[model samples]
Target: MALMTIPLIIFLFPLAYSPGPGNMFFAANGARFGFKSTLKANIGYHIATFIVTYLLGIGFGVGVSYSPTLMLIIRYVGVLYVVYIAWGLIRAGITKRNQSAKHASFIDGVVLLVLNPKAYIIIALMFSQFQPSTIDPQFYFIIGWISAVFTLNNMIAFFFWTVLGDKIVGLFRDKTKAHILNFILGSMLLVVAAWMAYN
Candidate 1:
């Protein structure tokens, strides 16, 4: 178990930092609204991530995925949500670039994390690597503790992605360049949505 720590950190860091739906979502928000405005949503996202990770680590995750009917429903709902978000991002970029509209609300952050399929798979794989053949009395405690650590890392990754997007926009302050940035971000969102639907 002790030897697993290093490998786990290495595995998780890249996975958390990678450009997935969550990272892209934050990046888009920061590009649209700046880091200061996105902080609360970031907090909400991490809170949701922690809760979902904890739930999966403890046991409920298995039951939820075991039912094919329920899993199918979740899959379709998630796909629709991704599409909706992609559409909204594109619309915002094209029509509301000059306005200070809220691109992603706090509740939106929470809901996105909860519904994100990649998040669940990552949490599941993380625990699977650590679980022993037999249940130990201290298992849940360890799981909770490790999940807190993972959540912290997750939050940090989100901050970097958000800041990166914010700074990128700051560099291109001209209207045309800013619009180009928005188009790129919106395009990335569309690609993510398509990827989610395909996978």
Candidate 2:
């Protein structure tokens, strides 16, 4: 249990920090609506993330990781959802419309993370690498610790991206630059969606 810390951080930090679907979604929302306004979504997203990670760590994720058919279905659904989000971003950008009125709500964020295949994959991988076994005397303790750490790491990652996007909005005061930034963010979402489909 003591030996797992370094490996866990090494494995999770990059994935959490990288421009994945979840991070990008939050960042995009932060840009559209200020970070303060997006806190509701952030809270919802991280709560779901924490709960899902806890379940996965405690041996409840077996069905997800082993079922290839379920994973395939999830992948396609996730791809479609991500594409839909990308389209929204692109539309908002192209129209130069401040979409604060129609931005994602707390429930939307919860649903997005719950359906995201990448979130499940990341949790499953974290559990697998940690090898949480019932036979181990410290199973529950270890799982709790790991879940807490993972959730904390994710919280930091989410905050960083959200703030970065919030700052970016100020920088891109020009309509054309703002439009270009939105397009780039939308493209990043599409790329992540593609990765989800193939990987």
- Candidate 2 lDDT score relative to the true structure: 0.81
Candidate of highest TM-score: 2
lDDT of model 1 at residue 59?
Answer: 83
Runs with alpha carbons beyond 4 Å of true place in candidate 2: 1-3, 93-100
Listing every candidate in turn, what is its Cα RMSD in Å to the true structure after a full C-alpha superposition? 2.5, 2.4
Error of 2 at 110 (Å): 1.4
User: Residue 45 in candidate 2 has what lDDT?
Assistant: 81
* lDDT (C-alpha, whole model) for all candidates: 0.77, 0.81
Write candidate 1's Cα lDDT for 1-199 as tens digits. Answer: 4575667788799889988888998898787777887887888888988888888787877876467676666666776787776677666533233446765667888988877777877887888886545669978777777788789888999999999887777665776776677778878877877777677
Q: Give the TM-score of candidate 1.
A: 0.87
Worst 10 residues of 2 by lDDT: 92-101
How well is each residue in 5-74 modelled by candidate 2, as lDDT tens digits? 8789899999899888889988887786768777877778878888788877776877776799988988
TM-score of each: 0.87, 0.88
